[model samples]
Target: MEEMKRVLKETVDRLFQEMNGRFVRLNEIDEKFGFLLDLKGLIYDEKDYDLKKKCNELGQFYVSDIDGNELDE
Candidate 1:
């Protein structure tokens, strides 16, 4: 488990470093982190997660889109 966490961290860090040279938007980063956080919560059993409950909390500052691009404002 520790090794998996280490590898995941390293992979994410490497991706971030690689993307540092590109033109990335701030909200795009936020959306990506939000997706990651949601997965992390599920993995760590932060609570009894469900689709309906999560959907209700969506955009209320909890989970965001899982695999969608951020819309233009």
Candidate 2:
């Protein structure tokens, strides 16, 4: 009976260790994915700002052209 108890305890301990390792791995994956998402967001924001600036410049050029101002100089 004592030997059976020892074997059961060892099995439980091994299972717990495996589960803990898996949990740690999953947490690491989550952290990495979060970082990637933040980077993607930042890139998109920069692109949006660049597009907005271009649009504004184009609008100014159109207005200046209508006023007979030289745009190429």
Candidate 3:
């Protein structure tokens, strides 16, 4: 798990180094991470995750599109 996290951080840093990753606020990062976890995609880490009533927990805050793009607010 630590290795996975390290790889992810390295990937983000490398990508930002390659281009522009603007300075987003901490609250915005929280919102974006929440958006990612709450995203309903064609693939699921757990097959029965939907049956667990998780999205209901997310409520109005989970509004990103499948591609993780923010829709009009």
Give model 2's TM-score versus the native structure: 0.46
Q: lDDT tens digits, residues 9-70, model 2?
A: 99999999999999999997664334334555445665444434433454465665432223
Best by TM-score: 2
Please, what are the lDDT tens digits per residue for candidate 3 over residues 1-73? 9999999999999989655544455556665445445556324545754422334434445545322222211
TM-score of 1: 0.30
RMSD of each: 14.4, 17.1, 13.5
Cand. 3 TM to true fold: 0.27
What does candidate 1's lDDT look like per residue over 4-71, in tens digits? 99999999999998787453566666553454467666566555645344434443444354312232
lDDT on C-alpha atoms for all candidate structures: 0.54, 0.58, 0.50
lDDT of 3 at 36: 46
Highest lDDT against the true fold, candidate? 2
Clashes of 3: 0
Q: Tell me the lDDT of model 1 at 26.
A: 62
The window of 10 residues in a row where model 2 has the poorest summed lDDT is: 64-73
lDDT ranking, high to low: 2, 1, 3
Candidate 2 residues lying further than 4 Å off, grouped into runs, are 34-73
User: For each candidate, how many residue pairs have backbone atoms clashing (under 3 Å)?
Assistant: 0, 0, 0
* lDDT (Cα, 0-100) at 35 in candidate 3: 41
